[model samples]
Target: MCAKTLRSVHEHRKPASLRGRSFKRPTTGRFDINGDERKFKKKHSKANGIVSPMPNGKPTTSKKVNGMVNGVNGHAVVHMEDEADTSSGRGVATSSKYAAIQEQRANLPIARGETHSTIPAISIHDPSFATIGKEALLNEFREHDVTVLLGETGSGKTTQVPQYLLESGLAGEGMIAVTQPRRVAATSLAARVAAEQNGRVGSVVGYSVRFDERSSTDTRIKYLTDGMIFRELLSDPLLSKYSVVIVDEAHERSLRTDLLIANLKTIQQKRNDASQGKGKGKEKEKERLKIIIMSATLDAEKFAKFFPGSKIIYVQGRQHPVTIYHSAQGQLDYVDSAMRTFFQIHVDQPPGDVLIFLPGQEDIESLDNSIRLYANQLPPNQQEVLICTMYASQAPGQNAKVFNATPPNTRKCILATNIAETSITIPGVKYVIDTGKCKEKRYLAKNTGGGFDTLMTRDITKSSAMQRAGRAGREGPGFCFRLYTEESFKSMALSAEPEIMRSISALKTLFLIGGLDQSGEITQLGREMAAFPLEPVYSRAVLASKEYGCTNEVLTIIAVLSASSKVFVDSSEQRDAVAEARKKFKHGSGDHLTVLNVVRAYKDVALSENKSGRREWCRKHFLNERALLEANDIREQLQQTCERLGIDWKVSCGDGDEPVIQSFGQGLAMNTAFLQPDGTYKQTMGQSTVKIHPSSTLCDKKAPTIVYDEVVYTNQIYARGVSIISKSFLAGLGALKVRQA
Candidate 1:
């Protein structure tokens, strides 16, 4: 018997809800089972009086007699042919259900004059949707393939535009993909959109980030990190699945965002060529991919010229006017000024939260302690003050409380790094204290060498200052207390330099991966490098590991280096304890191998315990649990990329740590330095003098030559993560260009 026939028989034998219904007759049908015809009785209900022929001339639906019937006991032998073919008829039922749902949705009234009203009521009531520019925003998309959308923080562009596209049937062919620079923003925006549509997350609206994805095939709109979208390009260069690509927060100008925009231009050109019947097989473009670039403070004219035919749409944000305050003179100590300003606002201003922007985590922590001390001094009857600190490396569980509403009769003071400048929204903030500084990673060329040092702290640009000021007005009319004088503000740069302008090595690596030669010609290696999710430095390291036969260990080292947060947590009070705990993973070679040991130990512990126990284990060892988790995730991704590129990477570590260290030297040979007799180090390339960072385990012990991960300058130039290596190893790697003094 066919599968469907068997299913029908099984379904009939099972208890069902239709027990009260009476059968009229048993229809005549073929008995294909066992290839034999089985005679059965027909039954006719007295009410209906319908009749059918049976071998016994008795009713088939009659109650069993003496528990014996047509070759069976206490069971009616029903023919399979009498049942309707449910498998073939199910499509109609499904289609009808969907049609009814769609019809009901179509009947709902459009919110705020939008073409569709599936979004939340608050979104519809946003002033951007009711503004005069709303129509122009829609019309621009209809006319141009690329649109530069400029709006301030409170503008509804980020949340509403995608829905507008969906309502207009512009995204009917495929999903509308929106990219955010940070993961938190993507996931939060997805939740807000899902709430507006009255749908559960991961259905019509979803988000994807590093190691976390909450999207399904039915997702009509997706919010993903810019890095996530770049990874998608490795698999689908054309991004064929998305009909519309929205790059939000374009003003941030991150490395990934810049590369994605450049690659997207290439994608659009390819699609145009394909549509013109120029490519192999003459496969016409199935859909024309539309692009929308949204930014709070965009360089509109520059972007317009970049995309020749693109149009610019400026939407005024809905925000109350904010009053700005500047110091009478330039304040040399911003931390002191910020503290004074905080108390001033708390004591004089109306009840609202205070947001103080600092340069880095160190500043946030120091200021947070000071604020708490001052809060404790206040009278117990006074309104309570809650202090919170926010930085990228902060634990997520604590970060969630940053957005919670303050309790009645209490005020919240959030001391944060530049992360709050654009990546997040902290509600109920009515006062903003801007230090006019932020920690920016800049590549400073060595005075006498070809290489550069990475500087992690720098002054904020004028554009950044404006973004910081705008945060105060997000909720209501507010005040911005600038720690610097107006003259100092004007002296700042127009905008922070783009990542592309600062990192030449990164650009060179990108070209190499794009298959471009010295003269900028594309090569096969360049193409493969573009697909790797790591920076060119790490990607080159993994690619080179294959030659040294230590790809697995090198991959792990790179993942640890790419951790989202600091792996080591050291505070003044627990410095000795933290150091003692970290010593367990020291491999006696350098920080690089130490990192490998940490990863191995973490994995071993993670496997043997539940998640909570694993967290406790990391805590006991003074390791950042989140950082280790992120590193493990990155390691897995890099390994997958290696496999995809057909690199023969062994899954296990080699016999010893020497081979792995040698492989790392092969990739970072140019970063080698020689130890000077004076206890300072000199770079092999420029003979530049540097000191070993205090954090490096090899700082005290000396070796002739060392390979370092980075050279950063704070009070003095310091080589961090120093690993000692033999002179012979350096010579073999061709890194002994500068003779040891």
Candidate 2:
């Protein structure tokens, strides 16, 4: 069913009291129902009153009422029928207000060819309709099975192209699937498109991400992450549910995005071959899957060569001209240079917000601190400055504040990483400070085994530098101050290397688990691992846990790892308190066992307290309540995945540290490292030097051998999520050879 049909069914099912009601706009600019206008009356209650300012800058009177009401000169009024009281008596007034607004909208005059809808109508006067090359894009899709769409930053390709396909009836019986590189983009775009279509979300338009989904069977247009679509391929190899697949943000070239494009190409070939040999009826003919590659800075010729005879469509972006400034000399410390440039723009430039792009959280924090110290020296007459931070691990609530409008007589300086480059848009940003560097994950190759390291900070590509500069021009004409010289930018690479060159373990594991023979054919295990929504290493660990007799414990550990990092909150002020509270859950075996203890204790506390109490418990103990809650959700989902793969979900070796450690070690045998005499650790397989991170519980303690979740280079090379393991246990895994120095 379409959204319009669903909405009609819902309208017919409304309560009798709400149906056939007449609404009128009163002379006072307020809603009056059934031709009746009631006088304002004040009522007193036990709760305190709220006072708000009116348009004239005078405070409006407030009074207690049975439910929430619009403040009108201290009046407590109810606009709906008396019998339609809410369970809490507070929601009725809000509902009645919305109902009146809907009725008023329904009675509004429509254009000659416009259709009426209960939902707000989308304006047809959007500038994209006039500027975008709509006819050329539609014609390319109509003629070719594959097409590469190149658009500049504000080109409207992301939103406009999908709607064009929907309106042209290209979706057929399947959905028009659009893949985004980030969850925020997918969800926000889906909501925007749903509004433009005059429909509700999850009906005509929807989105799906890692832990959340708002799509339904009635959905004709779906937006999802690249990773989510990759998982879908394991079940529906032909993508039978989607007629058109759009890969957006292909310029980023993330690991999953590249994998998805490669797989889609293969699927396209097989489907075409099948269609050529079919004695098909008119209704049973298989429709060839149409693929559209959309990017803001995509190399059109390269993609054209990859997909033979593929057409390319270019759309012009609507962006203000941006002034670029390059450094005369390279500075030893980019952080200091960024600080000076930010202050210069604030004092000399016109009133506008500033966005400073740094390498990581540490760099952002350092620059933010320096800005504050310098801000204090400003004259009292100068406007105040508001500083915000943006990073991957930032709390969601705090992240929202970065997008809020700047207050009058003040400016906002958002210190961010590459996350703000293309994933999010911040308004009122007219100036950009580019550090010209970012942390990229790269794989190290040695004679022996090697793992991935993510702390390698390097100069960004010329393409990325341009993307950062484009942020300044999003709102209006602006300026970008690069900390590097023009000569240095010209020496940079054309684009960052693809993810396939950086990490191959997940790909290798996928092939192994798929049960492909020596020739690399898919096996049963590979199909199961693809269905599991986890990294290949973690997926393999879960499957191995069943054989090692600790599936339940390993499931919990993997889910927690997948959900978030260590649950302990890192606050300098509460460091001692957090460590003291965490003592109750320490298992001495390693961080993995400690995580198991934390999850079990959380469950126990949740069973004993109410919702608020559980949240309070986390705060009191300095634990991340969100991470723990997300872990629980993932744990339930992983349990279902295990059951579907025919792995026993209830098997356990009882509550002991040995079995759990052994189970996790089975999959992480190559990650084992042993202590050395020089107070450093070396990986048993790769022979790489490593050290325990200072944040780990076992940081100061000495252990002969340990297993780690990952290696990170910050102040120095360190292994995070460290845990002590028995030498005998390492030897028992069979992949490691126990050798003593």
Candidate 3:
């Protein structure tokens, strides 16, 4: 009944903010909203990798064959365009602007097939085309239930394997499912694959990411983020609609990817058993599922060990020999080092684009500005430089600029997080500069799920180092300049910890949200919780709202919290003005109610104003209009979910805030804290000290008892999405009914 909630959770897919999962961000000094550069005190943690200061930053398959476990390798990057409000279709029947967008896409540098296009006819130099014959590759997959395919970056495997299954009829009447670790990878790869197929998106090829879906009944092949697949499982546990499921970038081992890998194994067994007549009726002849686990590194032995009888195959990629050079000594500021190296390549080296890998976005922006400043100082004789900054949080339109063809006499310089290390391939990149660092999110697990997420800068792994260097050779022989000494490179780890081992386990979270019973079984409440496309915690809040008679307020608050974008606009130059504007919606109850106030204000304006007027209102308030629109969409979906579940979403408490706060308290029981005598807030469950995030409306304010959405660590452990509540409300939370599955 709550299925609409689950479906709508991912319906508004602007790539989610870079949080929780493993992605890239920045390191070193970050600019505050007031334009002040505060030096980040590096906090070290033993969890993920070695969490250290600025010096750096920075799945599955079975087979029986054996060999020494070597380093993992692979490279695939996405180029998803921002179309939050657009349809999944791409033909005339699609959005009116679809054609214009398609035309613009055709001009992208990589789309020209000058380097590593997956289409065989357009990519003659791609290694997969040269060595791995389509028929032979299909034969391997045909003979094996699981095949661990190890290929290097630019191998064309990520984009080619799905098409092979589709054209060969290996997928039968069912769809071919490909799972990527990131949303951008799924969407961009879908667009590229659709272009290769000569069919409109949502027809023959499409993608499903959080809040964004672009597929139709005619779609024979689909791309989805790992998390999207999990939601699909809640409805189709058997994955009956797909004949083949390919897990790409298996080596990254993000938490979701790992969980997905394990689940796929179980699914394969059940489906194969059914197809063999192990069950009755329709289950007796089910379509057997085929799983292909693809990784960039040659270390397929681990995957082989995981799946009995699975085969391991290595395909050579199109990468050419890359000359590597390391700095004589460590540079304290890799950003400055990167700037000097870019000029070295631009002024003295051969002509080609340059890619500089940083730890995160803060450094990317820092380097972007630095490069432009120096480029302007160069003589007329030197070529002009075009700098593009790429990160998870960047606007889709801006990230797309990295794929544009370089202007005449202009050198393209891309400053990016480790996202450039793999998630995409930019044509004509001949020089690579590695800062030897990246930002990572690690869950510091403690008792009671009071652990916080820390985004710390650490050295890149050895495998990552190889991947970064491989970017230089996408098309031809290239050069890699390492900012650290070779000795430091050897000291790096072979790969990152599997996300499951480092991050909080799904079971713990599910249990805390009342989705599971003590016996580790899914509860009836959990089933209902899964029906909504929200985190278990948020879904629990919705259920709790039923008793509070404040479903309207609860849904509104949660919708904004669930949106992918931030509600407030952050501008350094207008910091003071932004704060002043934010005061209009300030609530003594803290950020959560402040958000409700903002939403209420937006709704009032929406009723009395036109589109332009609404936009003007948002601009004047220093608010993000896109976020509000997305939140409104989420709220509508939640309302529909509530209706289907027989919960009256229209019921509201009007001016009373107590019932609403109580409902949230039930969901946030694991996330609540109380003010200590020392003036610091200590979590009720874990007793860990936390400060309200600076962006929170209640920052530095004393709230006797507070409930927070999450804890994020930068220079300090800070709680975000803060709200005040009564201790008696929390004490009465146990009175809420718990149902079993």
Model number with the top TM-score: 2
Q: Residue-wise lDDT of candidate 3 within 1-741, one digit each (tens)?
A: 122332232233222341122111122232111111212112221121111112232311111110111111222222232212123334433444545444433332222222221321221222353234556677778888888877655446677778778888777777889998878778877876776566677889989987689999999899999999998997899999998899988898877888898999999998887688666644543378889998755345677778888876665444455666777677666775677778767877778989999987667765676666556657777788999877765655567799899899988998888767765677789888999998888886666444678888899888888788767765555777888876787688878877778876567667777788889999999988877878888899899988999989999999998988777866555779988999999998888788899999999999999999998998889777888888989988888888788889999989678788778877777778888898788876565788888898888888888898988888777888888999886565444323212
TM-scores for all predictions: 0.75, 0.77, 0.75
- TM-score-better candidate, 2 vs 3: 2
Poorest 10 consecutive residues by lDDT, candidate 3: 59-68
Residues 397-481 of candidate 1 have per-residue lDDT tens digits of: 5667897889999999999888787656677888888888887766776454535655565678877876787677654556677
CA deviation > 4 Å runs, candidate 3 = 1-132, 187-198, 202-219, 277-286, 319-322, 350-353, 361-413, 419-430, 447-450, 473-478, 505-513, 608-620, 730-741
TM-score of 2: 0.77
Q: What is the C-alpha local distance difference test score of each model?
A: 0.66, 0.67, 0.71
Model 3's number of clashes is: 34
After the best TM-score superposition of candidate 1, give how far the Cα of residue 238 lies from its true spot, in angstroms. 3.9
For every model shown, the clashing-pair count is 11, 8, 34
| Candidate order (TM-score) | 2, 3, 1
